[model samples]
Target: SQQGEEDPQALSIQEGENATMNCSYKTSINNLQWYRQNSGRGLVHLILIRSNEREKHSGRLRVTLDTSKKSSSLLITASRAADTASYFCATVVNTIQGAQKLVFGQGTRLTINP
Candidate 1:
């Protein structure tokens, strides 16, 4: 499993604050995406940046990638209590089956105190 792991198994934040997470991978990959899960449940795609790109931003989300270091970072600004959720980094790669899959990490738990 050529997967990556995010640092800080858990995080705590206050409403209207910000949160950041880091991910480090093992091998080369085609693309990496970040996802968010609520209450350890369903995952929703948050952002995706490919190998050819360096940084991308959407609304309150900002993502940066460093292919040389095989790592990435995500920053969320002005978080709300509802923002409390687990964030995961997924990698897409070619397989012997000729299709790609999203492999997940343990995730970083973000808690927002109201």
Candidate 2:
């Protein structure tokens, strides 16, 4: 079962503004990852934060994970029209089979208007 659910089903922002999206999960996770998908394209890995990590950043993207609350948030600074896309949060869990499973959130659709 999917464990993550992103808040704000949709978001619209003007170019150069900041965009934030949140995700909540129900179970313990080994790590969490964020992904972006453009229209009709594959998901692009954004960043991954391990359970031991509290925050991570890459370029304009900043991610913060709060395991105590089972939630995470992604912030995009200086948003651009090209940043418009669907963002998803995925959780990695270890199964009894000794393998890791990745479950994704519903997603947040962000629209960056120029």
Candidate 3:
């Protein structure tokens, strides 16, 4: 079962504009992370926000977590054509044996047109 779901299934924007993606999850998690994947390539880690953290930033990327709402958002400022890709939100789910694994959202596809 998928733990996370992203909104705005698809997004299109002009280069230099900003792109925002939202995610909501069903279960309690140790941390939430965002990843970006270019077509035909593996996902690249963007940022990780722990359950205790409300917000975090790295470069032009910003992430926010709301444990009470069981939601999170990712903001990319001044997006470029190179940034065109699919973005996903993932949650760390703990198992019975004290192990954890990532469950990813459906993902948001962002397109940047020049």
Candidate 4:
């Protein structure tokens, strides 16, 4: 499958600490988007990095993409308890019919302890 799989299915860290997660995929993609979902909530888009881009940042979040390795990583600096959520990496692939499909990973559950 072209879906990306995040490493360390679950992570725990103290508030104010940094949290990092990694994801790996099997196929080529146009872009990769990161989403965060609070427990029992809808997903919130975090960031997106195009195949030509190596890294991107938004507020306290940093994302790096390595197309050569078909992998990506997300870093959350100075995490807070409210940041506890499930993070997913979705890859956008172009189909032969000229449609873009978004494939999401299983997700990495992050817990920030107070």
Question: Using lDDT as the measure, what is the rank order of every candidate, best first?
Answer: 2, 3, 4, 1
Candidate 1 displacement at residue 35 in angstroms: 0.6
Alpha carbon lDDT at 32, candidate 2: 94
- Candidate 4 per-residue lDDT, tens place, 7-93, comes to 889999999999999999989888999999999999999999999999999999999999999999999999999999999999987
Per-residue CA lDDT of model 2 for 22-58, tens digit only, reads 9999998889999999999999999999999999999
Worst 10 residues of 4 by lDDT: 1-10
Evaluated at residue 36, the lDDT of candidate 4 is 97
lDDT of 3 by residue, 4-90 (tens): 999989999999999999999999888999999999999999999999999999999999999999999999999999999999999
Error of 3 at 14 (Å): 0.6
Q: What value does the lDDT take at residue 12 in candidate 1?
A: 95
Q: What is the lDDT of candidate 2?
A: 0.96
- Lowest-sum lDDT 10-residue window in model 2: 92-101
What's the ranking of the predictions by TM-score, best on top? 3, 2, 4, 1
| Residue range 18-69, candidate 1, lDDT tens digits | 8989998877878889999998578899999999999999999999999999
Off by over 4 Å in 3: none
Better of 2 and 3 by TM-score: 3
lDDT of each: 0.89, 0.96, 0.95, 0.94
